[model samples]
Target: MSKPVIIIGAGGHAKVLAESLLRGDQTILGFTDPDASATLFEGIPYLGTDAIIFEHRPEEILLVNGLGSVGDNRTRQAMFSSFTAKAYRFTRVIHPSAIISHIEVEMGSGCQILAGALINPGARLGNNIIINSHAVVEHDCRIGDHVHISPGAIICGNCTIDDMAYIGASSTLKQGVNIGKGAIIAAGAVVINDVPSYTLMAGVPAQQKHQLQGGVK
Candidate 1:
């Protein structure tokens, strides 16, 4: 008797999330997209715009923006806020193929953990976080809200990644490090110390390059 769920987007990520929901034994009530003209995706219908969610008032729904890096993620954040204001309950989506350690893990709502991502025990992932393919969050790490751990990144144990931080592909965070809010670690950067807020750090050993103001690079 799993609750019925509504998917918010109809793009590639939505397709993957839908499959994960199905595998989790949740009933997917189809997707809502402004551009939807097709009858269905993966055997589920495209149910017009997002207004249908308010109309239907399903007991449980998961909203996901399938767009890749939606222009600094402002749009996705707004949508998430709107849904929260509307009293919609969001659920986390974890792919069945992912390997989660038996140790304590706290994952917030609307998290999408992709296949091959390894979440070790004692890790805490905040709301709307994306642990992308092959990313590894070692034990005792705290990942803040809306943080995106890109593919192949490795965060060592006891690290704290603050809200809206982006860990680029193949980057590594050393043990007990703190990455500040809205910080961007470039691809292949190796972090050994604390990264300040709104800074963009890159290269091996991760030197600070510049500061970002209000998501502007």
Candidate 2:
């Protein structure tokens, strides 16, 4: 039997996660959000705030990271790390319609692969990664922890996306490119070269815009 799951956010992404779990025939216990004012999220109850997590033992429920990232993933990364330290277990939520073309594709805990996403052979994804709707992860790609490949983003073969990096919606990364840790790729940007850590890259042929500090998420 699949374990009951609880989501940690109450946003649009959290609703999507709830639907994905239902499609997989998995039961969701509901969600918890400190800033949520609604009583229900897509028919699931709001189970109070962060303090509710303390009420249940880690082994009794599985947690799913429901927070979405536009460019910064520090919040998502921190939450996952914090819950993990408390002995809470997480599981991947792969939409039923997603295509996994290769047996060599490895995904870690708390990863979310949305519908229409294609993960080709030789793609390795680390913990808490998000391969969003219709995103394509080509062969021989290495994606680090807390990385978010936004909707329709295409990562070419042999590309390396480092930890906490965010590839914006519809962005395309050329083959053999290395994206540094915490780098942000803007929407519709086409990257042909390497991006440095904590840099913001944007434009047609992505160029470094400026350096970002810790709080710019």
Best by TM-score: 2
Tens-place lDDT per residue, model 2, 90-158, is 889999999987678888999899999999999999999999999999998999999999999999999
Q: Candidate 2 deviates by what RMSD?
A: 1.4
Residue 49, model 1: lDDT of: 88
Task: Please give the CA lDDT of all the candidate structures.
Answer: 0.81, 0.90
> In model 2, where do residues sit more than 4 Å from their true spots?
39-42, 215-217
Model 2 lDDT on a 0 to 1 scale: 0.90
Candidate 1 positional error at 171, Å: 1.3
Which portions of model 1 miss their true places by more than 4 Å? Answer: 38-40, 58-62, 65-67
Write one digit per residue (lDDT tens) for candidate 1, span 91-184. Answer: 7788888888887998888788988899999999998888887899999999998788888999999999998888998999999999998888
**Ten-residue segment with the worst summed lDDT in candidate 1?**
65-74
The alpha-carbon lDDT assigned to residue 136 of candidate 2 equals 97
In terms of lDDT, the best-performing candidate is 2
